[model samples]
Target: MTLEGWIVIGVIFLCLVFLVGTTISIDLVLFAGLAVVFILGIIPAEQALSGFSNEGMLTVAALYIVAAGLKETGAIHYIVKRVMGNARTVKKAQLRIMSPVMVMSAFLNNTPIVASFIPALERWSRISNIPVSKILIPLSYAAILGGTCTLIGTSTNLIINGLMIEEASIRSLGIFEPALVGIPCAIAGFIYLFIFGDKLLPVRGSSMDTFQDPREYTIEMIVAEGNTLSGKTIEDAGLRNLPGLFLIEIQRNERAIPAPGPYEKLREDDRLIFTGIVDSIIDLQQISGLKPATNQVFKLNAPRNERMMIEAVVSRSNPLTGRTIKEGNFRDRYDAVVLAVSRSGERIDQKIGDITLKSGDVLLLEAHPNFVQKYRNSSDFFLVSSIEDSSPVTYDKAWIAGLSLIAMVVLAATGILSMLQAAIVAGFLLLVTKSFQYSSALESVDWRVLIAIASALGLGSALQYTGAAEYLAVNLLEFAGDNPTMALASTYLATWLLTEMITNNAAAVLVFPIALSLSQSLGLNFIPFAMIMIVAASSSFSTPIGYQTNLMVYGPGGYRFTDFIKIGLPLNLIVATIAVSLVPYFWNF
Candidate 1:
């Protein structure tokens, strides 16, 4: 190996440990490393930064906006209602609910698709007295399967496509490219989840919690003197500022203080309760110069009468974002109270006092049932009302969004409009039609996913431009050495391993460049390699950490680590075998 090869290997190793060993945000870490590579001349600056403008990155961003539009308009929830309507039995509900969900995921962003169905699945499980564990895992798995069905089904597909076109100018990847292998794999996966989901998966709350939520760690802590504004009320103490402190209880000496006053003095022995985000407690302790009482970055709602949690999606065109909830009169103008907010699986625990409203932040509103209905079908927000009703469509306006989206899709597919432009235009039109609010759509776009995609794409570009990808491929081929099938298997297995440790999109971005090189060297077609990369990325079936959809259901499903192992391990292996076998056939290699 050359000196550069050793350096590259070291970088990859450190990246691995940093990602898996610590909670340092993976997106920032990878991108920072990519920047370092450019500074070191490991990658040309153009190649290193070109990924920022990659078509796949834009597609991912645009798709989020479009999905946000659907979510904002109550369209996704509308689909869920239609799917689960009159479904009585757990078995029937799973088939009716999960089957369609998997199918929908094939066409949409898999994460949103899974998230969109969560409430409906939970409701159905509760109504049928079925264990949510019986359904949620399958719900997640189906979405993963659906993701494999088309090029746009998952960001991994688009991302890998972007990498290939950039790396080698491969045109074989465009236009319904993935359906050849993806459709069959999705079909097989759907059947597999249907047959084994219940038996293999545990029921929700089958363990410690009443829900299938993960094992939450509970810790104790006390406040320290000399902290900034120690004499300030708890409200001013910035207890809310402390990350990972999900307040559970407050202790005074030996007695527990349930709800201490914000103005209460920080007695030497006062303890605060907290829940998630525990990792950041130490940082809070250091920054605030507060002694780490057993409780960590310790950190709810107004009175039951005044505080309320309403789940509402920001309209795609909402202008309320970048402004505090107070500015919009969220409580007054909306006739509802914001009790809690959930965004892309993470909860915003801050007091709704003055937090800015973002689109796609599922505002859990606390309000009267009467007012909740009024919020439903409103263009400004999506009211997640349990009471179902057929919306009186402004037929003209509805078609405007529908036709615009279709035209965008058609234009892109036919090569009239670049996919990036198509999505951008679609997002804008949704706003003009008031199908969703523009400001809301922009605010609601999952910025985290966007960052992750951009960063990973940059990393992929670095690896390729620096010859890291080709070097990795040559090494693999030296071992597999002329065995095309083994070469395929090696890349698939390697991608799967990385996914088990990092984001699936990141995994795809890392592996696609190598897989592309492998295909070219072996004189094999690129489609099979592309197929393997796509399927492998989606095959994060083994652990909750492997996929966000899995993690979202982790706590809610109350599943143990072993729970995923028992159910997902087998599914992972099965899909792996089927994907590898089908890819070669589809690509005729």
Candidate 2:
């Protein structure tokens, strides 16, 4: 291997470290590495930025707008309402969630599909008395499996097809060609998750579980002087049965009542201390006379309805990391009031102003809508996310949005227009028809994912331009000389391994050239080999990092890395087996 090959290997190793070892954004890590290699003259400048203009990348960006249209118009909400019907059992519930997501994911991008479903699943779990932990992982896996059933199912498929058109001799793939192998894989993967997933899945405590977070937040809610609750007994005040929250005590003037009995009478200006999940704070906010302990909230400019509730994970680089909330003047500094703080399954139990902030601490905040837009990209936060249904939806335009999505699929699937062309028209219709606002559409695109995909493409290009990919492919294929099926299996295995370690689109980009080179080396049709790479690359079930949907579910599902390993390992093998076995049959040499 040349020095360039060694450099590519070293750069990829560093990327893995940045992705796994730290909380840095994946986009920054990938772009930073791409810049390093480009500066060192390992790859040309044009190739480094080529992904920015790649058809696959742009199509992904366009599709995000379409997904946003569906969400903004309440089309997603309506669909979830109708489909998630009276799910009485876990299996039935999983089916309800998985079936819709699978079908939607085949036409829509899986990222937004999973995002739209999350809130629905949460709402359903609460209503059905089912643990959300059992449902979220399967939701992600279903999207992944369903994506394999069509060309437009995932960005990775378009990426592989785009690469084939530019680098290989074969014509572009038809919309459903991969389905020959993909449909089988999807069915097999779905069955495995449906049957064995619940058993392998851990029953993690919900966010409100006392055992999960021991240091319960001590929130002081002061009753108004003239409110109806002022003269009522503790039980008569209607304070009990606050889901996931408990009224621990009451404070009146100089007296402290510990664990007040149900009949204990309440008085004006009585202070109530509740210990529970941060999410339940909204319930307290709704109580007519119960104002939060802090007056700082009264100073915020926005009205309650116009503002939003957000959760941000403090990053190491945040300037507020070492300071107390009081010392930092967090409310004034960020125009947001800290409602609660949680750290590693433990809620912080102290006066909101006195607690010190730390990296990885989750802070629940009540802030203006602009707070998210202002600090979403700040380095101080590893993640800044708004809670689901936090923003108002345009219910009237929902059918328009739904119909627009259908049009995009029908046009692209029928080859009346390319996926890219159809997506552009659909995205334009969304904006023009007021189904999605332009400003909102721009925000809806996961630019970080796009940047990461582009950067990974650059890195993949570096391998090809430096001759490293061909060098590696030739040496790797020598062992599977005579048998094409052996070669096919070997190709699937390599691509699958790469996908598990890196972003799926990048994995496909990096492995495509190798798949092509091996095809030529064996004098076999490149189509079957390309199909194997596509399916193998998109089937990223073994690790959370392998797919975006998995990562999105990790925190919400209360999942550990090993949780994915336990469930996803077998499913990964299931899809790999079906894909590898069926590829040669459909596109035989």
Q: Per-candidate RMSD vs. true structure?
A: 18.0, 11.2
**lDDT tens digits by residue: candidate 2, 321-359:** 999999999988899988777787664556788989999
Candidate with the greatest lDDT versus the true structure: 2
Candidate 2 regions exceeding 4 Å error are: 17-25, 52-55, 88-91, 103-137, 150-180, 199-389, 416-428, 433-447, 498-531, 543-566, 582-589
TM-score of 1: 0.51
What digit string (tens of lDDT, one per residue) describes model 1 on residues 1-589? 4555456556656765665566665556666666666677776767767767866666656766765555444454345546765454556767886777776777765654554455445533443346777778878888888778777777678778877788768764754667777677767776776777767877665212333433233334456554444555765554543333455566776676665655665655455555542123222322232433411111112222112234467766666776777677665566565534456655443445556777776554445445566756677875465312111121224345556556665766566777678778877887766675455567655565455556555665555555555566456545666788888888887778667644577677777766777777778877677778888888878755566667656555656656777888887888888888878876776
Q: Number of clashing residue pairs in every model?
A: 40, 0
Clashes of 1: 40
Taking all chains together, the TM-score of candidate 2 against the true structure is 0.61
The 10-residue segment with the lowest total lDDT in model 1 = 294-303
Candidate 1: C-alpha lDDT? 0.61
Error of 2 at 478 (Å): 1.9
Worst 10 residues of 2 by lDDT: 207-216
